[model samples]
Target chain A: MPETKSQSFDESQSAPMHKALQREIQLARNIQMKLLNGEKPELPTGEVSGISIPARLIGGDYFDFYPLGDGRIRILIGDVMGKGIPAAMLMILTRGAFRSAAGAAQGPGQTLTMMNDAIYKDLRKLGSFVTIFCADWEPATGTFVYANAGHSMPIVVRSDVGTVTLPVLKGVMIGGLPGQIYKEKTSHIQRDDLVFLYTDGIVEAQNAQGEMFKLDRLSGILVEQSRQTAEAIQNAVVEKVNEFTKGLPQKDDITMVILKADGDQRGV
Target chain B: MFKYELIDEEATTVISFEGDLDIDATELMEEEIAPKLYDCSNIKIDFSKVQFVDSSGIGLLITLIHHLRERGIRVRIFHVSDEVRIVFEMLQLPDIMGADVLPEFEHS
Candidate 1:
C-alpha cells in the first residue's frame, strides 16, 4: 500500500474526474458494441450471426463478420487476456489490427500473421496475449478455410456426423513470438451443417457448485440443436449456459458466432 | 492466493512462491520483489506450490524478466508443476524467456 502518485491519489479531489472517467469507459463500451454488432453479412446461400456478452459492464471478448467482395465472408472471434477495462482496451487494439489485416490479407492464415506482426510487440510489451480464430466462407463453392492462434476450436455440426470440434490449426497465440507464420486448413460444409465459433469464456463459465460448463456440455447442446437456425441455435446455447450457472456472477466474457450452410433459405 | 518467502542462499536470491500466480495476486508479488531486486544479481523463482496462472500473471513475469535483463540481473525458474507448465509451454515461455524452466515435461 505504498502510495504511488497515481494509485494513491486523493479520491475526493477527483470526483468530477472520476465521473468523467466512468463516462469515458461507458463510451468505450458503446463503441465496441457498435463496431462488433454492426452490419450483418448475409450469405447468398447461407447465414451468419454473432453476439457477445461481457462479464463486466464492459468486456474483452470480440467477434465480427466481414463479407469479402468475392462471394466469400470472413469471420473473426478472439479473447484478450484478462478482463474488464484493461482487457477491453486491448480488445479495441486487436479490433483495429483485425480490421486492417482482414481487408488486406488474402486468407485467414495471412490475416493472423499480419495481425500478429502488427501488434505482437505491443502485446508482448504489455505482458498479455490474445487467442483468435479466423475463417473465410464461400457459399457458392462450399469452401471454408480457417486458422487458429491458440484459440479454442469451433464446433462443426455436420448433418451426418453430429457435432465435432473443428480441427485445431497449429499456431502460437498472437504476441507469443515475432515473425510467426500461421497456417490454415480447408473443409467443405454440407447443406445442413453448421459451424459454431466461440471464445473460451463460454466453456469456462462456472456454476455455483464450482463446476464448469465445459466443452463436452457445449458440444452436447450443439448436437441436440443442430437443425435450428443460426440465431435460434445461438440463443439456445446462451439459455443453456444461463440455466447451468443459475445467476451466479461470472468472471469471463461469453461470445459466440454461428453459421449454417444454406441457412437463409430455411426459416427460423 | 499466494505466499512467498525470500531466502538468501549464498550470493543468489531465491523467491519461493506457494499458491496461484495470477493477475489479482500480482500486486502482492510486485510489492515484495521490486524492492529487493536491486541488491541481488541472480534470482531463482520456485514454483513448486503454484497451482494456477493466468495471462496477467505471465505478463507480470515477462515484464519483470525484461526489467531484470535490462539491469543485468539473471533469473532462473524451477519446480514448475504440470498445471503451470501447460501455460508456460503454450506461450512458448522457454523460447521467449531464454530460461530453462521446462527442463522436463510432465503430463497430468
Candidate 2:
C-alpha cells in the first residue's frame, strides 16, 4: 500500500490514534497558555498588563514581560507568520530566542539582533518569520525605548499632550535576512501616558460584512480610554474588536500589552 | 482567491498570479503551484494583478521559496503593486526573493 496523509486520520483504521492526537493537542495548548500568560513584573514608575486569545486551540501571537533589574521593564510582543500548529511551534522557538537574547543584550536593538541571529536559520528552514516590537520601559526617566522588527508601530496615548501618536521605528522582520540589524527609537512617556503594544490580528479583525476593525478604530478607542488604567485600556480595546467582529470567525491570534505611567502630571 | 498560470519556457517557468491570496485560497494555490514548482532552474512569479495577501498566503509564498532555493532555483518577482508591496515588506519578502525583485518598495 502506498503511504498517504489520509491514512493517519482515517476513522476506519484506528480510533485510538484520534484519541491520542486530541490528548496531545490539548497538552500542547495547556503548555502554550501557561508559558505565554506568566506574571507581569512589578514596576516602580509604571503599570503593565497583557492578554492573549488564540483563534484556534493554540495560537502564534506572543507577549511577555521581564524585569531588567535596573528599574526598567523589558516587554516583547510579536506575531509569527501563519497560524495554528506551524506558527505555534515557531512561537516557542521565538520565545526561547527572546529570553536568551534579552539576558545578554544591553538594549532592545541588540536584543533583536541577537534574537534574529539565533532564530534566522530555524525560521528560514521552516519557511516562516516573526515580527517583534521589543521595548524597555525606563520608569525612572519616563522613557520608552523600543526596537522594531517589521511590526507596526504601537499607539502612544499622550494624556498630558492630549494626542495619540505612533513612535518612529523601522527594521526588517526577524528572519528576513541573516545579519540584519534593527533600529531603535524612543519616546518620553509622560506621567499618565500609555504605551500600547499588539499583534496585527487586533487591527485586521473582520466583521460580518468583511470590513476590518482597522487601526483608526483601535486608535480612537485607545485615545478615549487613555485615562483608564492599563488593565481597563486593554479590556476596552479587546471589547471594541469583539464588538466590531460580532461573532465572526477569528482569523488569527490576538495579543496585546499596555503600559501606563504612574504618579501625577497635572501640569505638563 | 487567486488564479495562477504556469507558462513553461525552454529554460524558465513563469507563474503568474491574479487576485487576492487570503487564507481561503491556500489550498487552491498549492494545487496550482506545486506541480510546476518542482525541478525548475529559473522561476519568475508575476504579481501584477495580485491584490492582497494575508499571513497564510505569505506562508505559502515562503514555503515555496524555501523549496525552490533548496534546489538552487533562481526566483524573480515582477510587477508588484504598492499594496502588495506593503505585505511583502512586512514579511520581508525581498530579502528572500533577493534585491532584484523589480523595484518593490516599503511604505513609510
Tell me the whole-model lDDT of each prediction, alpha carbons only: 0.82, 0.81
Q: In model 2, what lDDT does residue B11 have?
A: 96
A1-268: candidate 1 lDDT, tens digit per residue: 5576666577655988989999998898898899878989866788888999998878888898878889999999998888889899899999999999998999999999999999999998887788898999887778989988877678888866887555556577788778988899998877788898988678878798878898899998988888888888999999999999997988778999998887854443
For candidate 2, the per-residue lDDT at A109 reads 94
lDDT of 2 at A118: 98
> Candidate 1: misplaced stretches above 4 Å?
A1-15, A264-268, B2-21, B33-51, B69-86, B105-108
In the order shown, the candidates' DockQ scores are 0.38, 0.51
The DockQ value obtained for model 2 is 0.51
Best by TM-score: 2
lDDT of each residue in B1-108, candidate 1, tens digit only: 677889999989998888756566667757777567766898888888986776667767777777777788877788889877866776667766674433454321
lDDT accuracy of residue A224 in candidate 2: 85
Query: What is the alpha-carbon lDDT of model 1 when measured against the actual structure?
Result: 0.82
After superposing the true interface residues, what Cα RMSD does each candidate give?
Answer: 2.3, 2.0
Could you say which candidate leads in lDDT? 1
